[model samples]
Target: MESIYIQTPLGIAKIEGDKQGIATLSLVEDVALSNEIPSCLQEAVSQLNEYFSGERNAFDLHLNPQGTDFQKKVWKSLEEIPFGKTRTYLEQAKILGDVKAIRAVAAANGKNPLWIVLPCHRVIGSDGSLTGYAGGLWRKKWLLEHENPMRQQSLF
Candidate 1:
């Protein structure tokens, strides 16, 4: 698999993929930025840069995240969430046709591998609270705020 590390507003982003598609896109504590991006990952990197710059609201890259069928289904559904919009875990479960699967849905969301592209960050708690995120709650908050068209105000 080919890989590349790029600087993002939040931190360094570690992107791994191959001809099949981008498999994993996650944040790493530290890593030197990649000087040369592989051809297979160039488009993904460009899209990500656009996303971070707010020029792009949706991703259109071929994704190949590895997971169980159920997980893939959940991730695909996550893509249905519109940019700058939020969905509660219960709402996501209902969208999947099984409100009782709320916990499972949230678990799958927590395991999402595509990061901002898949938009697991768009999912929140029933009470509109930011809950679980593999990239850390702070990053989650940052992502949600970034995607929000209404600028987030800073409190001193």
Candidate 2:
């Protein structure tokens, strides 16, 4: 597996993968930025840069996140979530055909390895509050606002 570290507004992003496609992309606090991106991860780096710059809303790179069957199902469902939108854990469970699986759904979401490519950050608390995010809540908020910048409504 090849890896490359790039600096983002949030922090350094470590991207790892190869011919099988990208297996992981996560933020790190301490990693030297690579002056050159690996051939296998170039596209991912480009898309991620575009995302941070607000030039891209969706990712289209090949992904190969490793996990169990249930986890894979949950991750796949996360991808279906539209850009600039949020879904509650309960809603995600329902979409998976098991509303009672909210806990499991949320757990799987937390374990998602591909980060932004899989869009686990789109999930929010039932009351519309930001919740658990491995990358940290602040990053989650930034991602959400980056996708859908809230506009001020002027009083008429």
Candidate 3:
């Protein structure tokens, strides 16, 4: 697997992948950014840069996140979430066809390997609050706001 570290608004992002596709794109704590980006990860890096800059709202790269079958299902559902929308854990569980699986669905979401590409940040608490993001609630808030910047209303 090839890996490259790049600086992002949230922090240092460590991306790893190979010909099989990108397996992981995770946030790391205080790592020196690398000048060289692996060929396999170049597209991902570029797309991520565009995403942070608000030039792109969707990703068009092959992903190969590693996780259990249930987790993969949950992650796939997360990808279906719109760029500027949010889904509650209960809603996600309902989509999975088992509202009783809310806790399990949240657990799977917590384990999502791909961050922005899979858009785990779009999931929020049932009460419309930010909660349970592996990258921290602050980062989650930043990501959501970045994706959907609030527009100022005219006071005419």
Best by lDDT: 1
Record all residue pairs in model 2 with backbone atoms less than 3 Å apart, i.e. clashing.
none
Model 1 spans with C-alpha error above 4 angstroms: 152-156
Return the TM-score for each candidate structure: 0.94, 0.94, 0.95
Candidate 1 has a TM-score of 0.94
Clashes of each: 0, 0, 0
Candidate 2 yields a Cα-based lDDT of 0.92
lDDT of each: 0.92, 0.92, 0.92
lDDT of 3 by residue, 54-94 (tens): 89999998999998899999999988999999999999999
Model 2 over residues 63-85: C-alpha lDDT tens digits?
A: 99899999999999998999989
Candidate 1 per-residue lDDT over residues 1-156, each given as its tens digit? 999999999899999999999999998976688899999999999999999888999999999999999999999999999988999999999989999999999999989988898999999998988998888899999988888889958897
Query: Which residue pairs show backbone clashes in model 1?
Result: none
For residue 84, model 1's alpha carbon misses the true position, in angstroms, by 0.7
